[model samples]
Target: MQRITSFFRFCRGRAKLKRRAAAMGFMNHHHQTAISSGQEGIKTVGVDNHNLCDFSSNSDLCICIVTWNMNGKVSYEDLAELVGSSRKFDLLVVGLQEVPRDNILRLLQAALEETHIVLGKAIMQSLQLYVFGPKNSDLLVKVELQVDKHSVGGFGGLIRRKKGAVAIRINYKGFRMVFITCHLSAHASKVEERNCQCKHISHSLFSKNWNPYAKPAHITVWLGDLNYRIQGIDTHPARNLIQKDLHGTLTSNDQLLQEAERGHIFNGYCEGTLTFKPTYKYNVGSSKYDTSYKVRVPAWTDRILFKIEDAKKINATLRFYESMDDIYSSDHKPVKAHLCLKLNKLLSA
Candidate 1:
């Protein structure tokens, strides 16, 4: 009887493994699925074919992107401020890292339900990205794209969702736009690993196979906890500068900026000025720096950046870039940026 029970257990485990493999294989199918707020509840709606909606020659889209690392903790605080509830943005792109649970999605949907609806979501274990648009807005051509590097230099099996990227592509009135959210390798020492992951994600997500026409996105917005730290600065001095509000001085040593300047990562991407302070290594539920034994040096790990395909056809203006300090639900403060995406049809012609 004992031998029979053991054999049955082994067979059950094999069945579970087969089921997981099937689910992973199904992830390759990209579907345009959206959740909208209705009188009954949240409902998933399948997007129909494209060319259903159109815009004027000179169209403008007000976009707001927010990123945060939750540190695997659940925040009971209201996320209205984090979602920029006061402003009426046409599109809201949210990226979160270290999200052990997805309860925050309900909180976010509740916060924006009155004005916006969830267009799509790409989730890979702990990394999640959600895109929201106005509830009454017109339908546009859109595609959901997600790519995960399950094996990053042999670390993928160990780390899993701690590092990966998800993207959503949208073609609005013939202009293409892509929004990507990623969580790169952590720690200041893993700068090269982060750069390599960034390059891989940027190239892999928008490849020919993902799009039907094999055309690239016109405007790409990348946001997330990139894990790049400030070099040549000790923790003590970095904290001193933070207290003195000398963010400009500290940015000179920013790893991401240095890498971009050297054309290593995000070669064509443009980021708003670093007027806000570092957004990471904060004490949970407080404004103080890390108080643990590691005493991680504060860094601007959460960021929002963008790239434009053609300057003549599209114009991007940064309206506001800031960090939410009052809400300290996690070890990292949420960073938010607002931008105006304007397209001129005359220039393209």
Candidate 2:
């Protein structure tokens, strides 16, 4: 009897593997299949949301998105290493905060030249959202920009500091996506305020334009220095947990997750599992956490989140999610996320 039971278990496991293999094979077929390609050479169009719900649909659209807070310092040194490997992703989205607006934009344009990627949208100040795609790729077009800057810090929300967010929407082979990068309120005790900021930013992005597709974007991406912290623990305990490489355990008290569970912010967005050390409050040029009079507890304040409509119709696969400690110009190390996306049979059909 025991032998028969073991035989059945092995058979079941083999069947599951076969099913997974078949599903993956189907996805690869769509990714490799070319649905459309634009005219060759660099093509820059004005921000136009007038041409959505009318583009042809085909092929897999792979996207890579990176978000960082420069702390008023931008490094062109590890720009290539920032995204690590492209893996032939069709699109690249960069969201930034506290950066040199003009020079950083120029740096991106120059650095991207090596990869032969061209800008899809112009760079905005401080809070920046940039779109890049394969040169001469016509699969993604009809790009549009909507920027909303609401001061949440400094001088009673009057100055342009820790601002709201910047967003850019584009249609890729009939896929609609709105990419937004924002810098919310800081400090540990301001969780409610951060939640409010999130609500405000969400409303601003979805309501900035009159176009229906423009407002209620199909796939919305929110990434930046969100400033969420670990709560219900003293600074020393948090630091000790981080020192012991127990970052995963510390996330139980993450303010952002708590807010989401309470249905107060980012109700439907999903975040990839964070497997890296805390990315904030680091000493410049050192792996050690802040060692000053104000010993700030290390936290994963810098993060990336995503929201989607018709979840059954599309799939998001996270290839990697971690921080870049090598690029050490700011107190908060830059964090990165790589995502491989696919459309379902209904969308493809």
Candidate 3:
């Protein structure tokens, strides 16, 4: 019995050694794969060098943006050029309001090396939107990539029955990050409901129990067409109305104001600009509408907001790239943030 027990133990030790050896061999194989295929084999489980998070030490910054109500005329080719022309952000998040079909989304996915998409709520035939991101070249190389979804409460009213929101998560360069795309209620009366929805989203994120803003790990970026504007205490009437409605809520009017004041949430286009551009407008050129001479008006309804931790990493001169000149893409202009994540330095001790 003693001899038999000794023999079993020896066998078990040998088996463990064999397993370790096999794992090492697999890793070596993947390294060679990465070298030969570039980004194609970077998604393998044991591979560590090719992920976006593992970007070159010199590549410290990432750029992102959000646009809403891009009318149906914007094409994937146009969007790619816009992104390429911009600061080459590591990730791009766009909240597309009124994306009539998946054509543009599909085109973007193809144009970008590695892309992900999350479809937002569709209101009427013309009011569909989506969030897109994590433009890494290696994401498509691996067969193990998985995409998941999280839904948030949207503008609930007669005109828009279900204003939905969705989140997308991806693993890049050894870190995982989350991006949320939201389109809140547009109706002036649903301010309270929209506040509740935002609270729910906050709760859900906390429930995940993951601090995306922390160092050496994942980062969370909450961006989209928040449908809220950040301005002075004596600013636009629309801003005042929103403040009045949420004066005594649990979230607090001060907290909301502080978010904008402290730079926790930034308005990409409002910092230096004096005028408000309305993202939603009547398309005069469309054959469906009359071609009579009428004044074209714009509103600053569509906007991009981000958390303080993420905002701190950006350059001070960030602004919206308004030179695409494609009026047909959507009524809303896309806003971008040029950020360089200094990986060489640590955010914490």
TM-score of each: 0.76, 0.76, 0.51
Off by over 4 Å in 2: 1-59, 85-87, 122-124, 140-160, 212-215
Top candidate when judged by lDDT against the true structure: 1
Candidate 3 is scored at a TM of: 0.51
Instruction: Rank by lDDT, highest first.
Output: 1, 2, 3
Per-residue lDDT tens digits for candidate 1, residues 156-203, read: 342244666777776554557788888877778666567667766766
Candidate 1 C-alpha RMSD relative to the actual structure: 14.7
Error of 1 at 10 (Å): 37
Candidate 3 lDDT score at position 268: 26
Lowest-lDDT window of 10 residues in candidate 2? 38-47
**C-alpha lDDT values of all predictions:** 0.70, 0.67, 0.42
Q: Write the per-residue lDDT of candidate 3 for residues 63-97, one digit (tens) a residue.
A: 45555555446666666764564334555655455
> Model 2, 1-349: lDDT tens per residue?
4653464355446546544766677432322332222112111112122322111233266677888887776667756666555435667888887775446666776777755465555244567778887776554354444444444433122223446677776766567787878887688866656766676666655464456543345688888989999877888988877778887888788888766655557766778777788888988778788999999878889988877776788866665567888888778888876655568878643
Candidate 2, position 211, lDDT: 68
**Pairs clashing within candidate 2:** 38-138
Candidate 2 structure lDDT: 0.67
